[model samples]
Structures are given as structure tokens and as C-alpha cells.
Target: MNPGASYQTELAQKLQCFFSDQQQGLDIPPAQLYRIEGFIEAGLLAGFITELGLKQTLVDSAKQYLNVEVADFYQQDYRLILHMRMHEAPVYPSSNPPCPQS
Candidate 1:
């Protein structure tokens, strides 16, 4: 599978499993699942985008949405550079025990 599609599928499956395990006795319907999935999907996209260093696309989109120039759009948020670079390291969530660090 393409990497992006694989990531999205994994994220959706995680959300499904989380809701399933949480709502064992209660009635969790498809609508609720979809809402929760929407939130999770948005978060996942933002996190992945940040990790993959898509600052220009993010900034350009923000500018279009907010009706501002690129410079003005970034004036108050210069740290997006650091965020998408230094602090955006990818994190793999694994259920298995971690291997010994050599």
C-alpha cells in the first residue's frame, strides 16, 4: 500500500479499536464513530504534515484562509519552522515491548 494510505488506514483502525474497547456496554453508533474519526483524522493529518515538513503548504493554506499575505501570516508564528523541523520528530506507537537499546 502507499505509505499515506497505509498510515490513514492504521489511524482509522486505531480509532475504531479505541471506541470499541471503550464502549463495550453502551450503544456507540456509526455516527459517533464517524465524528470521533473525523477529529482523529484531522489530528493525524496535522501531526503527519508537521512531521513531514510541509510548512510552506501549511503557511500558504493559512494565508488563503485568513486572507493575509504570507509574511503577515507567519509574523506571529515563526516558530512553525522549529515545530515542523526540530520538534516534529515522528513517533511510532507500538504495542509490542520495545527492543533493547544498544
Candidate 2:
């Protein structure tokens, strides 16, 4: 048996248990359930990281980055950070392109 098999099994159990608990407590409509289902992974990952004893600052920072889609959908600050990270320009660009330096 692979040495990491136990760890994998434990993680799977935790994911299932976490998902099940959320599924029970949530009260969303059936029509929206499929779409809402995808976001659960972000919460699950954050929970797993916390359970593994990662530092709170690191966990919060990583979760904020990882769930940027959710943040953008909800109009949160991470959307701006995500846009800045994605930009190819070294400096922030305005509506007009930067003028070449002499």
C-alpha cells in the first residue's frame, strides 16, 4: 500500500463530512444548487488547510487569492488584486498606453 494512502483517505472523509454538513445547513433553491455547488471547493480547501495547522495569516491570504472568482462575483477587493496580478504591464496602465521614455 502507498504510504500516503491513509492521508488521502482521511482528507476524502473530511471533505465528504464537511460537504455533507454544509449541504444539510444550507437553504438554497434546487435550481441554483448546481451552480452554487462549485464554490464549495474553496471553502473545503480552506477548512482542510486550517485543520492541518497552517498559520492563520497564510491561510487567509491563500484563500483570498484562491477564491478570487467568488470575490469577483461578489464585488470584493480581491478582484482588483487579481486584475493587477494578471496585467502584463510592469506599471499600472491608464486608458491610454504609456508614452515611451526618451
Candidate 3:
């Protein structure tokens, strides 16, 4: 089989096994399961990386392009950098309070 097909099959099997194990004892609804699966798939595609690791890697590659040092760096390492930047950004509170619900 082609690499892409093989990867898809593997991913499917992993998702099946994961949901089956999760449902063994607990009562989880289908909608919840679907949502959880979406999160899992997203993480698999673009997941978190340790801040220390990312920093060290960047420091090591400061003089050169990261892609030159690591093949497919854009596919994974770049995402980590973006994730870190987004998460580390400062959040400011709104001046106005939220409207009270009836």
C-alpha cells in the first residue's frame, strides 16, 4: 500500500482502539465521543511541544535556517513555534463587564 493509505489505516485503527477502551466502563455519549475524537485528531496533526525543547532547538539553529538542520521542520517544528507564541501572548481583560443574563 502507498504510504498515505497506510497512515490513514493506522490512524483509523488507533482511533477505534482509543474509543473502545474509553467506553469500556463509562457511559459516554456519541456526540461527546465525536468531539473528543476531533480533539485527538487535531492533536495528532498539530500537537504541543515542550517550551524548553523548542527554545533549545531554536537556540541551536539561530545561526542557520531550522529547515536546513531538520528535514520537514516546517511540518512540525514551525507549528510548535507558532503554538508557543500564541499561548504565551499576553491576555488583557475587557474594561466592560459582561451583561447579566435574565
Candidate 3 wrongly placed segments (more than 4 Å): 26-102
RMSD for each of the candidates: 16.7, 15.4, 15.1
Q: How do the residues 1-102 of candidate 1 rate in per-residue lDDT, one tens digit apiece?
A: 866667556654654453334334334456655665465446556664343333454444434433355435455575443111112346889999989999
The local lDDT score (0 to 100) that residue 39 gets in candidate 3 is: 45
Candidate 1: C-alpha lDDT: 0.47
In candidate 2, position 39 carries an lDDT of 32
- Scanning candidate 2 in windows of ten residues, the lowest lDDT window is 78-87
Name the better of 1 and 2 by lDDT: 1
Predicted structure with the largest lDDT when compared to the true one: 1
Distance from true location, Cα of 99 in model 2, Å: 65
lDDT scores of the candidates, listed in order: 0.47, 0.38, 0.43
Q: lDDT tens string, model 3, 1-70?
A: 9654564455445444433443343344566556544644454465332345434533344213223324
Candidate 2: how large is its RMSD? 15.4
TM-score of 1: 0.27
User: For model 3, what is the alpha-carbon lDDT of residue 35?
Assistant: 59
60 in model 3: Cα distance from truth in Å?
A: 42
Which segments of candidate 2 are over 4 A away from where they belong?
Answer: 26-102
